[model samples]
Structures are given as C-alpha cells and as structure tokens.
Target: MRRLMSNNLILSLFSLKMFEIFGCIWRYIAFVSNQNTFLLLTILKNDFITKNFNYKISIKT
Candidate 1:
C-alpha cells in the first residue's frame, strides 16, 4: 500500500543519514591519530638530535 511504501522510504533515508554521520566520525578519528603519530615522531627526533649535540660538546671540552 501507499502508507507502507512511504514508511519504507523514510526508514531508508534515516539509515542513510546515520551511515554518513558514522563515516565522518571514523575519518576524523583516523586523521587525529595520524597527526598525533607525526607529532610524537617529531618530538623524538628533536630529542635525539639535542642529546647528540650535547654529547659532542662535552667530549670536546
């Protein structure tokens, strides 16, 4: 019947919207994790460089 078809249409639309929202959330999480990893790597690299520089200076003195 007409009422049944309309109900089905509304249900499908609602499901589609929910799916889109979840997809966006997933992508955001992935992006944030990647950014955090990059930051951690940068900090570790700088620390290593600084330590090496200090060690060399100490050796020279």
Candidate 2:
C-alpha cells in the first residue's frame, strides 16, 4: 500500500511538471508570432523565473 501510494504521488507530480512545461512551450510559441518587444520581454522574464524554480528544486533535493 505504501509503495502504491508513493507511486501515485510521483505520477501526479510528474504530470504536473509536464503540464507546466507544455504551458510554457505554448506561451513561447504564441509569443513568437507576436513580434512585439513587450511580449518578448515577458517571455524572457518567464525564462528567468523557470531557471530560479529549477535552482530552488535542486537546492531542496
């Protein structure tokens, strides 16, 4: 039971991460066609935030 529970938890976490990645990719694609400086800046900001998030996760692990 414990093993199953852990597996399910891991699966859920993985799915959430996948969803976030897809969302970011979709946003980036949308931004690509925008051709606006502000939108590009916003995408860059998101990239910075993603880098920070990865750093925090690594530190926690």
Candidate 3:
C-alpha cells in the first residue's frame, strides 16, 4: 500500500539521521581521548626530565 511505503520511508530517514548523530559523537570521543593521551605523555616527559636534572645536581654536589 502507499501508506505502508510512506511509513517505511520515514523510518529509514529517521534511522539515517540517528546513524549520522552517532558517528559524530563517536568521532568527538575519539578526538578527546587522543588529546588526553597526548597531555598525559607530555606531563610524564616533563616529570622525567625534572627528576633527571635533580639527580644530576645531587651528584655534582
């Protein structure tokens, strides 16, 4: 029937919109996690450098 076909069309459109929204959210989460990991790596590197510098100073003294 025509009505059944129209209903199916609407449902497909709705599902497509939902899929698009989910894709955007997934990409955003991935981007934020990557930024967090980069920040953590930088913090660790700085800590290591400071510790090494302190160790060298103590050895010299």
Candidate 4:
C-alpha cells in the first residue's frame, strides 16, 4: 500500500511538471503571435500613410 501511494505521488508530480511546461509554451506562443500582429498592423499603417501622402502630392501637382 505504501508503495502504491508513493508511485501515485510520483506520477502526480510528473504530470504537474508537464502541465507547467505546457503552460509556458502556450504563453510563449501567445506572445509571439501578438508581436506578429503588432508588426502587421504597423506595416499596414505605414502603407496607408504613404498612399495618402502620394495622393495628396499628386493632387497638388
């Protein structure tokens, strides 16, 4: 009975460690995706600004 309890304890500990590692990986993926989205937004914003500037210059000319 003691051996069974010890085995269960070890298994639980292992599962807990796995859960923590998976959590860290999930957080990292979320952070990276957020950064990618931010970059895409900035690129789109820059393109829009350039387009507007060009249009204004063309109208002036």
Give the TM-score (vs. native) of candidate 2: 0.51
Task: Say which candidate scores most in lDDT.
Answer: 2
Model 1 spans > 4 angstroms off: 34-61
Per-candidate TM vs. native?
Answer: 0.51, 0.51, 0.52, 0.52
lDDT, model 2: 0.68
* Residue clash pairs of candidate 2: none
Worst 10 residues of 2 by lDDT: 52-61
Q: Kindly give the number of clashing pairs for every candidate.
A: 0, 0, 0, 0
Candidate models: Cα lDDT each: 0.63, 0.68, 0.63, 0.63
Per-residue lDDT tens digits for candidate 2, residues 1-61, read 7886686667657756865886687677776666585577567767866875785466446
Report model 4's TM-score to 2 decimal places: 0.52
Encode model 3's per-residue lDDT on 1-61: one tens digit a residue.
7886686667657756765665566566657788776566556655755765675466446
Q: Which residue ranges in model 2 land beyond 4 Å of their true spot?
A: 34-61
Worst 10 residues of 1 by lDDT: 52-61
Worst 10 residues of 3 by lDDT: 52-61
lDDT of model 1 at residue 10? 78
